[model samples]
Target chain A: MTEASVRRVESLGASELLALYEQMCLIRRTEQAAHDLFMSGMVKGTTHLAAGHEAIAVGASAALRPDDYVFATYRGHHHAIARGATPEECLAELMSKATGLCRGKGGSMHLTKASTGMLGSYAIVGSHLPMATGAAWSARLRKTEQVAVAFFGDGATNIGAFHEALNLAAVWRLPVLFVCENNFYMEYTPIAEVTAVPNPAADRAAAHGLPGIVIDGNDVAEVHDTVARAAAQARSGDGPTVIEARTYRHFGHSRTDPAKYRPADEVERWMARDPLSVARQRLESLGVSADELQQADAHAAGVVEAAVDAAKNAPEADPAEAFTDVWADGGSTWRT
Target chain B: MADVITYRDAVADGIAREMRRDPSVVCIGEDIGAAGGVFKTTVGLLDEFGPERVRDTPISEQAIVGAAMGAAMTGVRPIAEIMFSDFLACCWDYLANEIPKVRYMTGGQVTVPLVIRTANGGGLGFGAQHSQAVENWAFAVPGLKIAAPSTPADVVGLMAAAVRSDDPVVFFEHKGLFASKGEPAPPDHVLEFGQAGIVREGTDVTVVALASTVATALAAADRLAEKDISAEVIDLRCLIPLDVRTVLTSLERTSRLVVVEENPYQGGWGGTLVSIVADEGFDLLDAPVKRIAGACVPLPFADALEDRVIPTADAIVDQIRTLVAY
Candidate 1:
């Protein structure tokens, strides 16, 4: 979106840039379809959509290796997809299908595919920061070069777990990337009004002895470039980085919210720089044709369509399923 | 025949043996390393295992537990200490919600093989916040294996079992029984999760207890013998994989039961033990089952007041007298 970030976008290959755009499109389509399904009463629980805050997850995910771990929040459709979770599994999970991720037990807020290293999407605010840090510690202890990434919102910075996690990670010099997708609002209220500092995440990074790096989250290239360098730094045994991405959410916090608390101008401002539009512009400026961009968008649309159709056809989560997977042995027995 | 080994020493022995056997096992707490834990349960760990495996973290319960969970998820057997069981409330989200639910929520994609060892029960005169037997908090949550050993051998053996368990275990090491002595645990002794040891078998009445209460119940049984009351004392080693069959079988022989728990009466493990007997072995009961537990209030600070609040040997004997008389 910026002339400076376009320079960063130039680092990515033409095809890699195309893939990032397509990935963002897939997340967008999946969320939009999920929203429709939720309104139609097909989705059982409240769904958190990451429409405007796509590049932060997608760009950051693209920068990491497959073996690296990602700890995401409830608004993590984009992060999950970016970390190799199929749109079908995520949508199927949202619809509570048996074929869904976690077999519909996690519903919307807890979509997890451990095989992909996308550890469960934690619903509690600021809960996963330390978890991701711990995961990084595991990698260090186990002698693996893998890094762990935690995607959270600005609201998490105010919570005690956030500070505790940052302090622990800093002291341990753990290989973790604390990516704060500052969507400007903590559910209904503006984060700035409640938070003490100006930059909630980056401003507090010095206290934890981590480098405070802020980025334009609307620019996928900037997010990818910054995260790539940070991940490399972590992999090389350099400490964790606190990355604050300035972004906004396109929709309400959850299924019921209208997000009328936000100013109309602010919403319009964020909408004007939507991640999808920004990605398209960056692609076109990089000598990509309009027809080529449309094809990628069309492919994304097709993926979402197939995913939604498959999810709808999948059987409902069985009553018996409710009593399964409580233990690692695949049984719900608490007592013998 | 063994020398008197303190219950506190067995805890460290258990962890040290596990750490020796498995390199993946790491211990983390506020003052575990250098300070050797506030209760000295983790003594000699940092010296034996070195600082890499034996770590001391900041006074952040959330950080300690969450980090342990994270490590556990990724093939590390972490033994995290929360100083006091009452402090479990500070990081309860991880214990009650996140840690237990990980395996279930992830559809077994992740296995949380970690142990949370905390100082439990209310006899050290540490007052309400520092001295509550808070295993009841973890008992309500599924996916966690709860272990509260009574003796020195049981402590080492149960600690081995907890560290080695694939399922997350909340091992409640009673603060009150730290100085209490018992037989030394044999080398590499790993206790099973659910086998409730019948420490003292009697046919007149069966009294079930765990942690510090097991000792109190044993003392009560000693006093009850003079009254011609044969009290069978069962030390429930693990609470989650509750050995209900053992409790029910004892009830069948005795035909009367009394659950002695150090946690308050409100949501203690006593309610669960009693319900199992009522539902499955109601015919085994000659009298209404009695629950001799801590009074339903904050554990008072004063020595005498605290004694009144928590079930003492006399209180347990009195409750059984009432149960046996009926």
Candidate 2:
């Protein structure tokens, strides 16, 4: 890690700093286990791992209170865990266990817990941008102090809903934080090949008359400070902010593909800048040791093991539940 | 207790009564305030409730619907207007994705008490751009509740019911029904969602209709009575939560059926009704189901051509005559 980033995380208290490192580790370990299970056919459906993009979700989510709403994309286990979803619940969802957050109905693509104010994890590209803006606008109308955050990939910035949502949020000065996780590749297509502009998608925010902040996605302290200030500004009714975190994906877009689209040297370089290792070194420099880190790891691993066991023992989803939730009253005139 | 009231006036009364009853209800749309609605359905509302409650928004359909969704989720019941039902294509994302799916995706933690009021169908030569009966599109969305009322009373009653519901509702008002006359419905009338009113009863044939087609269906029933065919006409006032029992009862008596609609013939509400009857009451049918609906082509600007596309009383009678023989 760089000297500057090291000093930045060292500024936080021992407990908070230790918790942040452990949280990122939990995300990495849980997702790594999920990747192994998926490859071994222990799980079903498409799984998108957030291996290299941990710092963005962990850092940004640490900025807000529990009342704040967060919208996430399909690659969302990290975002969910960062927003307070337990590692076990998220891991169980990937495994399609009954005790998953959505009772296994949402699986990897859609994990939501509204009680925590985590609005949803949408499967559609860029669809949740407008939804987040709507919720932020609602918060402003109702005079709530809570702000809404929308997290998406760099590819989503090209969709029509993204532009429409950002412009509307700017025009109304809605309390929203638009975070773009620019992981270099948008499902095998390089950012340079698709976007004519720079890598960080935050550059486009200026056109909407909003401030855009670009930070080192791998640096947790920089992401936290940048997002914390932006989130504070939104809660105080100072309009929205666009943050682009430049990062890389450790794995391919899904369970398949060996990331042949990327060069061997590029992967080695990002792996050298691993977020967990960077945070651990910062904590150690601040006098937290390998023994303390091991304790946190044990705690997280225990939590995940308990959660997976509980999920496996949970009851199966009722067949009638498929018909439920479609309507508020459990009735549709079309079905007669 | 009654006077000459246009369908527009009935709608205005509906909105005014809801706003008076609940402080949470408000109106938002283009030209809905001081200028009133495009058809003046919201005239004098801003003066009575003030601009904060009766809002006029930009022509952007996406912004209008999005603002309504935002307002609805935050304890405000907003009655948003799309100016024309045809304009809904511009904001299908807000309609189909964000609004209806909000409560469900959130696992019922929230409720969207919203109403989208728009005029559909063509008769005054607005042509294709301003005219299209796209209620089927709203019906296709799972979380949305839809209704198309044919009478002044039904429109007023259904509007009140829509604003009172906890779910999002799309109220499709036919442009052609604005001037059509009917007995004045109750000023404070409340209409149930899944109930269909049998306007006229006969035994020879059953014709199911909704919205503007209800009037045409009644007229066709009168003509069929003259010819001794005795056609029974059922007005499916509510489109989405269809009153299947009423339709089944009509089918039981008539033993023959025809569906008349203003929407496109292919994959229309007619097909939906046919499938329901075919699955539930196959033995009751004496003839192949006949569907009289709008032609697949867009509504033409020419008056005669427009007339040729929409379902008319003559068209309904022709289909009923063919069904009766079988």
Best-fitting candidate, measured by lDDT? 1
Docking class for model 2 is acceptable
* Per-residue accuracy of model 2 over A1-336 as CA lDDT, tens digit each: 122322233236667878888888788877887787788776688889999888888888787888888889889988889888887677666676656776656778887767777767877788778768867866765678788898999999888778877887887788999999988888889877889778446778988898887778887777887888888899888999998888888889987878998989988998988887777877888899899999988877777667656655666555555556656675433544
Candidate 2 lDDT for residue B43: 88
| Deviating ranges (above 4 Å) for candidate 2 | A1-11, A330-336, B26-35, B45-75, B94-111, B181-188
**Model 2 chain A poorest ten-residue lDDT run:** A1-10
Model 2, residue B188: displacement in angstroms?
Answer: 4.1
Off by over 4 Å in 1: A1-9
TM-score of each: 0.98, 0.91
